[model samples]
Target: MVTRQRLRRRNIGILALLLAGLVCFGVVEGVALPRQDQMEAQYNAAQNSPLTHDIARTSHYATRYMGNASKVTGLFRSLPLGPIRSFALDPDVFTVQVNLDASAPMAEIDRDRAYLYSATAAFAYIDNLEAVIFNEGSVAYRVTREGLLTWYGLDGFAALTADSAVWKTEVQDKLAEQDYARRAFQELFRESKTLSV
Candidate 1:
């Protein structure tokens, strides 16, 4: 009782369904998938910009010494009182006010907070100091010290406040080392730029 006309019509319907499924799949794979990939790439790039990362890393590493009050005290302990006082008064040497990014990671924020707190506490022993906080904790004064006793306890301020010239040489030597490190960092950054490009 089977008819050729009915069989042919049934086969034509099956072919039409298969054709529609193939078209839908092609649109999804060819158009939607590429668009999705492009959006993901853009999101990733925004999350991790190379320049921002490099700046943050450099600042964190370069300023790590500011977080250790004891170390800072030790470094300047042997310095002569006159040069120490002069350095403290020098606007170009001790004037520092850094505004950290609020969006930075918690670890980075904590490090910044520690540096500010330790530096401020250590420098509070200085006489005639004008340390001010303004703009909702966004600004502060330079770090320096002159007196013998701090709020925490006695630092190495006694020897530093005494007469000495050897410490000045040591300080200058340390600065030279830091300068070398900075130059090396710059060279590495330039190399990275070349590689990236």
Candidate 2:
């Protein structure tokens, strides 16, 4: 009777070992392996996107494109990282409320243009970050090719924190105060047709 029980116990132990091996293999092939492959494919796909290219180029342009001497100096000042405010205090992932003066004079327009560049530069400064602006509830027309191509969708106000991509609110309030979105970024990208630097 003792010998028979030993034989039975050995057989049960071998069965347990075999079952564990099959379970591990199933997890590897059915879940882990495929997930790894998918991540690699996504990385490869993202490398060549036009928006990625634009972002890279835009970053360079922001650094190089200085409108006027004073404007250039001023733009760098308002930058998210500038001497003004500690962006670190701002939500790491949040929307900004910019109030642009739509009725700005030619000088202000010039300044505004530089501000836009600085905004792009700000976006460039932060990695894995993004921003959007809305005037009275409509999207502007000055968005870059990359921005348009990569735009996912509208973000409800309640979801702002959840989105955490950082919105540049530099010109939104200014435009709303003036009640005109047409003059804000419209003439900047449309007429200037320039992406300096």
Candidate 3:
């Protein structure tokens, strides 16, 4: 019932589509997937390195002591806020300046989450750390060890940061919730909008 010419055209069109699909599959399998795998491998390597990213270092769990400023800097750098532009360690206070405008600009909730997680980690790992200050332009967020402890309760705080897995679940996972992060920030962090001259 079909003409020979019409049948030939349909077969050619089907072949063309098949060829295009094969090209796409080849590009993804040969190029895109391998690239993605390489990137993931690099990230995993970085994450596993203590010198680079030690925030998740389980070995530190047994000791629970970040003895010096250099070690503390490594911990802060490993945080999610990209990188620290500048860092200051004054006796017991740790302050860091970060570019809020870089890449993904942080919302208020995100800032709170970052501050809370950083503060909690700092207190947990740094033996001498009394407070952490995060500076973004004129605004600074300060979370004191005493304040955080009070917010979490002494026993609760100890339990929360006791282990890597527990810290991940209690602090990292819980911070993902905006409501909990909001309240936690309100209770733990003190915000100063204007830097005193």
lDDT of each: 0.34, 0.37, 0.64
RMSD of 1: 20.5
Best by TM-score: 3
lDDT of 1 by residue, 98-145 (tens): 332334323422233333333333343333333311111233223234
lDDT (Cα) of model 3:
0.64
Better of 1 and 3 by lDDT: 3
Considering TM-score, which of the candidate structures 2 and 3 is the better prediction for this target? 3
Can you tell me which runs of candidate 2 are displaced by over 4 Å? 47-163, 167-197
- On lDDT, the candidate that comes out on top is 3
Model 2 over residues 53-79: C-alpha lDDT tens digits? 122322322322222234333433444
Cα RMSD of predicted structure 3: 10.1
TM-score, prediction 3? 0.62
Error of 2 at 97 (Å): 30
Q: Worst lDDT window (10 residues) for model 2?
A: 81-90
